[model samples]
Target chain A: MRPMPGNAAERGYALSEVSCDALLREFRKDFRIFAPVRLEGRGRFSDTDMVRYGEIRNFREMELREKSLFSPKEVLFPPSETLFHFAETGVREPSLLREDGKGLLVLLRACDIAGVDRLDAIFLGNGPEKDPYYEARRKRVVFALIECGPLGASRSGSFGSCFCVSMGTNRASGYALVLRPEDDGLSLFLEDPAFAAYLPPDAVRTSYAPSFPLEDPFPVRVPDPGDMSRAVREESLFSAAFWKDYDSRCIACGRCNTVCPTCSCFTTYDVTYEENASAGERRRVWAGCHVDRFTDMAGGHRFREKYGARMRFKTMHKIHDFHLRFGRHMCVGCGRCDDACPEYISFAACIDRVSRVVDAAASTGGDDHDAR
Target chain B: MPRDIVRKKITKNAYRITSKRAETCLRVRVPGGHLDACLLDVVRSIAERFGDGTVHLTTRQGFEIPGIPWERMAEVNKAVRPLLEALEVPLGVTFVDLDGGYPGAGTRNISACIGNRVCPFANYDTTALAGRIEAAVFPHDFHVKIAVTGCPNDCIKAHMQDFGIIGQAMVEQDASRCIGCEACAKNCLKRVTGAISMKNNRAVRDPRRCIGCGECVLVCPTGAWSRDPRKYFRMVILGRTGKKNPRMAATFLEWADEEVVLTVLRNCYAFIDAHIDRSLPKEHLGYIVDRAGWPAFREAVLQGVSLDPPLRVAETLEFSGYFYERDRVFR
Candidate 1:
């Protein structure tokens, strides 16, 4: 609960001297240091020691300019890993041990800070499968958030849907390390002044306003409270034509769910080698709503068959149902979905489309638009 | 998220308590007709006696008790194994085959878009292909993802998939219905061609220039412009436009013939299952074919057709439909 670095009492290195090397020296001591080191032209976050930090002298060099090519969700919840290992011996009950914990990941984006919060809500917010491995890493790490400034060029197309600015996730809070460029050097702010005192003068001190302004035109609106109950009456939603058309462009790729900030669905995999099925660990990895086998059981009855039904369930749950329970919209608008979607099936755009449809229905009929 | 809270209300009886090491898992399917309370009790009792009393919900609409001790895990199998044998649930391969459950096997590979033509974005029907493949292919435990895109916007993450089928323009159009509004030209993300010029109130289209993203069809009003009938409903396969193991789904087949596509898919599934070990994660069909040799496997499985040496994979396909991009201004 100490003040961030750059207070009158404790001043870190001068802005210029706080080169990548200096920062690495400070970071590598304990934390598994991560920073927005440049990769090719675009910026990618990686282990701090792996890249040349000298290339990152000031904030300009730091790729805090735009959304990092990837979200830091994996830092806490990886794509795949064994939660525990299970094997049987003769007559004894099979013994299971928890996975080892790798502590502290240093991610530098403001949006990712909020993204971590969202992930926490999903994984640890009272579910039966509150992954202990995820919890261990999550609790151990501190978020080092660098604010955004200007735009950088991207390798991929489909940027139209990535409007993280509208999600109010464009800044960092809680335990944060802020950097601001100054004439003398830079000012650094840390949550702990004692920790800040170790640094030389001229560190960076930075500040950020909420990216998603209240006046922003595309504020995410929560669906009607009774939309679920009323949706049943709106039988048009259940129509075959509606579903086919809506899901016509679906590629069944799990990218949206994979890149999303809050998607927590996963499947347990029992990976065995040719030599030893007994030695392989029991792994749980991220899964998505879009994937068809996500619901397939021993038998072939798919619960969310019909492309449209999957589309509708994923969309409606994000706005109407999730908000009703979580007290907030599930989406932080990372725009990853927009970028990740090969078909550009932007959920945000879909929400807007559905909203307009309901609004039109409401205007025509006295009662609320049937959500079904 | 609210429903998740409701879904989180796991009844004490619904869980099977067991250790984590159990090699086998007990999957249970609860139908709408069954009494929820009774099922919960039976499931919970089974968990208490055999499992560790904890149930994990699968993405595929079933629940499993992870970490069951290897010794007792075999016993856990007995509980649901009988139910699977009974005609009661109609278990497909395993027990708890809930209708509408997530089909993780072949579904992970193929690109089946929603019937979005019914809503707004669809250029073709996706469900028909999904159903056809589901019936024809006897897929082993393989994960293949397929994407169905109706238009150019590609809203369904089609590009980032192993198999992607995007809608394309079918034909050259008549200018009389064009309206010279620039709707079609402006809406086309790829800039299909300079043929459809609004300045002259007349437009000419280059059929070769179109990749069939279907943007022009969606924007065109008065139906002057249309997709080529021959090209409509064309199917492309075997592209892995994904981040992890990036590979393109090869277009070894075309047309929307559900049965024919099924034959090819069944063959593909057999080849993959036979050649590639399921132990190794199979990212794309092209990769598997490349490593294991496609011609040899194809000849082994596909007896009738003489195999071609040079593989001309279809990168794109065309489709026809009444298309409409959601007009932000009007809405």
Candidate 2:
């Protein structure tokens, strides 16, 4: 079920109100459940009260939010994943990595679940080669969507820069359950009967809400996908002056790419042992368009030498370019990038500024609008 | 208890060298984002001799010497000890982690912007203040993030840090020194704040409207406007981005003096000591504050600390994030 306003078909799911602690306790007995957990101190990325995905050890620790600062994608696609390990000779097969035998359960928001679907498209479906590592992690997991309300400190559902409604990712399906806030705890709605076995044996069931709030409380709209593509075209924006001012403002911190749930780019390297050069491991780590070495190639020709060019590439990929190639837009409109940016660069604001430039350029018929 | 148990303390110590196996990167502290040319040679020599040839310029205004082998940590430490002395970093007395490896995973490297020493928008000396803070807070096994910026423009992003210190200046206008240049008024009206206006061939400043960014001081040609010798700061607390919620920090102190700020910092330590759970590996001070409730936290942090007049403390901190009220998870 979606939020309120429009009737959200429960489909085949059974909704029941129960205590959050109780729900988590029951789930923990059977599966490895991941939830939003507060860090004890400075985490890997930042020093804020950043929440990250961790195993739910305590029933009370399973907290929900409007959105997490970082995505739960780390559970499926880690910041670093070792593809294989090699020994002696040139290339020996990779050593086996440990895997949790039991299935996994994750509590996610609507946009994040949609982000999972977008990732699934690239790694699991309609691709030339399916990633076995990603598939292994993805196939064994279950998802439960959290319906966001006007819950203070629970600002995970709607973001000021969010455009999920416009992108048609506001409502999430294909999950095992959908949770809505009841008086003190949560109303656990079960979609897949297989997951119901994890609920308390004596638990009685209720029905999910017929509707959910379709539009974001505060939505920032982007231009038509086709128009956005044209606006970001080489001919139109190559010489546009709007993106030139970021040289001083942007420090290329790579915070945008780290916080984005849809970003799936990775850079791989071989880590050979000093004692035995023959024994090495191939590791895949996270990489993004904002970092300095993102475009560096073997011949020393960097495609995006300028910061603005890199910013343009990132923006186009997020809003227009990726959507053009893939049937669905890569961005889930979660708006984590805006919150995570230290320079306070708003990707949503870029669309507004770029749209005006595109309109002006279209009207003037290639007239230069350099304000620099 | 010996710290460094779960994972390597590299991330907490501002060292990120996961790209290479068995190699640790050391994030050399550069207070206020400025360093002497002499220190560069020291860093370069160490990098070339002990580690890889490349040194990364971290976004936090520091240097990261990557590719240092794990075994040469002590040698690297000895070579770089003099550079730390020049930077006035507290060595043997405090923050002496990294003997065998970076073991302590608490206080991060202090970050600051170039203040009045360079930038026109600055109000106070940011680098000097960052050094003082590092002296007071570093080497502890408690997680804290502090950043100092010269003005409200917030180049260093003071608001997002665990302890944010933003500089502010009180401006005074001397009518006798006014030459009617109108430069101060012009800048105030356009770029900065329109807190000053030309009246009767002399400049009059509106104290309430001024943001104290020192725009008037920079524009004054005849020394008509000057900054007050007294230093002022605004302290913001508890802003964080995490799994459950992400919210900017709320102001705890406005127009506070040096003593009040120091006392508060001291009390933060005391409060953490009193309330930190023994079972958990570590606990963020912000989370501790949330779990302890605002009343207990406010009283503990402000115990015996007197605030200067007109410097108000927040009566009710309007935190916009979620925490577990039904149960505590640290155990």
Model 1 agreement with the true structure over A1-372: per-residue lDDT tens digits: 224545444433344534534654555554565545544311111011111112233334554434444466766676555565555542221132233333363645555677777777777885667756667777777765553433311222223444455555544577445543344334455554555533533344445222222222244443453643354356433341444565678766555776676777777655455466665455565667776577887778788866667887777766666667776667766666766565777677666656555554455452443432
lDDT of 1 by residue, B144-176 (tens): 555555554555555555445555444446542
Worst 10 residues of 2 chain B by lDDT: B1-10
Clashes of each: 116, 20
Candidate closest to the true structure, highest DockQ: 2
Q: Score the docking of each candidate (DockQ).
A: 0.01, 0.01
| Residue-level lDDT tens digits of model 2 in A1-372 | 122222234332332344455556677776788877764322221112336677886545655643566788878887666688788555544332355466778887777888888778778774689877788788788887777643312354435666666566777788887776554556666666555555554344455542444675455556566765564463666577768766666666566776678788877777677788778777776677777678888999898877788888887777677677776778777777887776788776776666676666666664546512
- Worst lDDT window (10 residues) for model 1 chain A? A41-50
